[model samples]
Target: MKFAQPWGRQRLSFLLEKAASREAQTWRGYVAKKQTSQDADVSPAQRDEAVRWLTELHGRLQLYPETLVLAVSILDRFLAPIKVRPKYLRCIAVACFFLAAKTCEEDECVPSLKELAASSNCGCSPSEILRMERLILDKLDWDLHTATALDFLHIFHAMATASRSGFLDSIGLNRSQHLGLLTRRLYACLADHALMQLRGSVLALALISLELETCCPDWLALTIDLLRKAQMDSSALIRSRELVSRSLSTPRASLPPNTVYIYHPLQLAAPARRPLGTMETPRDQPALPQAAAGEESKAPPPSPKHLAHLQKVPLRCKASTKRKVEQMDVDDFYDGIKRLYNEDATSAVHEGATPGGGAYSGGSSPCPPLQPVGAS
Candidate 1:
């Protein structure tokens, strides 16, 4: 009864399917035209360089599959919008990772944009990462509901369990061991370098195949093989496994988060506290209660500054009630305001200060993106 008719579950699947359909359709033609047209640009060397960098990036972070998938999904989505070359390679990859960690990780301890900027060979500063994130989000049109590794985890679990329902139910399945192995295999999914290859969809497919091969091949792949339901060829699945192995063989392939990749996951421009002599910011400036306990929710009258910001997100409010900013014809202007206001408040508190106080700098750059290949 628990999973049966689970409220909103259907919606999740539907959204993921819709997004997948769109990515498939849009990319198919785009790939063909680019491949045939000399004007399409991007040489083999460039492609290899992109793949190697992405692979290096994937290796550097110690995130679980959940976080990695989120990062990868964000990168893929952002790729569609922001154009980059080896020149700005590390900056874009790092920016995308920051966005993904914020989106997926349960307990994040990454570094601040400033700290990362200090270490980056890319010469991109904290403000630069901050600016790039906004550009990335704008490029992707603020779509967040991508199918990360966690989403796929559930699917794989159900399929595996379904195949063994009788045996598992009767023998009292050691769900923990099984799940542990599955999670380790799942982490490997993040290593596919799908972000650079323009083959992220393959990563998901490859991950599922590897999980089956390593965990419960009988349940997942064997079942699929018997049913002949999957679209992938058996030989392709074998190649996917080999690639996963080859990725692991390269030690430089993945590494834990240091100043290089993982940031503190704090706000972008939050710590810029103005001197007391400065004029009080307009009704728009966002602020947070300084709960030394790091617990602001318990505060009784959490500064109206915080409340002033909450009312900014574009919730499902009636159009008549929405702000003039929200009513703007352009959707991103509406979104930028939300991030500048709502998330800025929360991100700022963690940053231990206020955002760049009312600079009003457009900080615009080339559009970047992240497409939730699994959802709308």
Candidate 2:
């Protein structure tokens, strides 16, 4: 159902009652504490529940781990502040995933709206499905472009694999192992379901770090786990995990998302766990900030002219086999291309005598291949 903006006195009182029922600190005290409490839907068991559902759904849909992680993020985000009844938890979580999929996947060809409603235990019609989509957008403050907690885990994995520590190098670990560790850590964070209490940029990183530390005490072990994921390269970030963690002590920006995120993982601290010669070395190393900045500043977004050129490029053409991939009905240009290319040598012979629009092998004069008799 479409809910009115929660600003009216009735809505405000509803929120107030929600806070009290959940024993959550009043919104008035949030500024002072800066630490979020376990949100109404956030708990050890709840996180596990969300993870299990997403993991299964993602597997069935054949989406990326990051995509599933995005679903988890949406669940955390919408459920973070609201105190929805437990009966509605599945509804809210499923709605968030549906919205997140539309946001991330260029192609939203998964299950139908009814299927999603069934999954969430809601018997909403397509119209209700559409309404919930709007409600979610309003609740999230439209911060859809920002990175999720899963991205941070990826950053950690990259740094861990890039570690030059004798311990890691001797074992000849790869990025796959690093990514594996990262995935485990992500799930394990839910083991305690402490993520809801985590907030902002660096603090969230610290909380995840603590959880990873607990799962496998050894730094090398965590590094090894990240090596196993294989989704991204771990080399670029190997030596910078510690520095990233230290800068995470206080977040400046959100470690940057996507490619820009790679350059400045974080600044280094004084010589400590990683010795200069042993594995952690920074003396002659290139300046990370400059490298990262250079990459980000390389070019501005495409201009209108460029966009026009891109638009001019047809999505598909008959001869253009690559970009011209067809869907549903395949007619028009495809038939023409096939007719023209029927026979390499029959061009002069057949000319415009072709019957059907598409090429025909059973024709009186079949076409020839793209070769002729002569030099090899």
Per-residue lDDT tens digits of candidate 1, residues 1-376? Answer: 0122222434544544554564554332112113444435333345334434444544565544455556556655555443455456567767877776676555445656665566444578878888888888787778755545445344445544555545344444555555555555545444434323423444445555654554453645454642243244666555655776666556544553243655587567743443211223235645543663246222222324544554343333122534434434334543465555554444333322224433232333243222335864
For candidate 1, what is the total of clashing residue pairs? Answer: 15
Q: Write the residue-wise lDDT of candidate 2 on 215-308 in tens digits.
A: 4447655544444432223443342344444433444222212324446567778433321111122467654575775663232222244233
Question: lDDT for each of the candidates?
Answer: 0.49, 0.47
- Give the worst 10-residue stretch by lDDT in candidate 1: 26-35
Q: State TM-scores per candidate.
A: 0.44, 0.40
Q: Give candidate 1's TM-score.
A: 0.44
The most accurate candidate by lDDT is 1
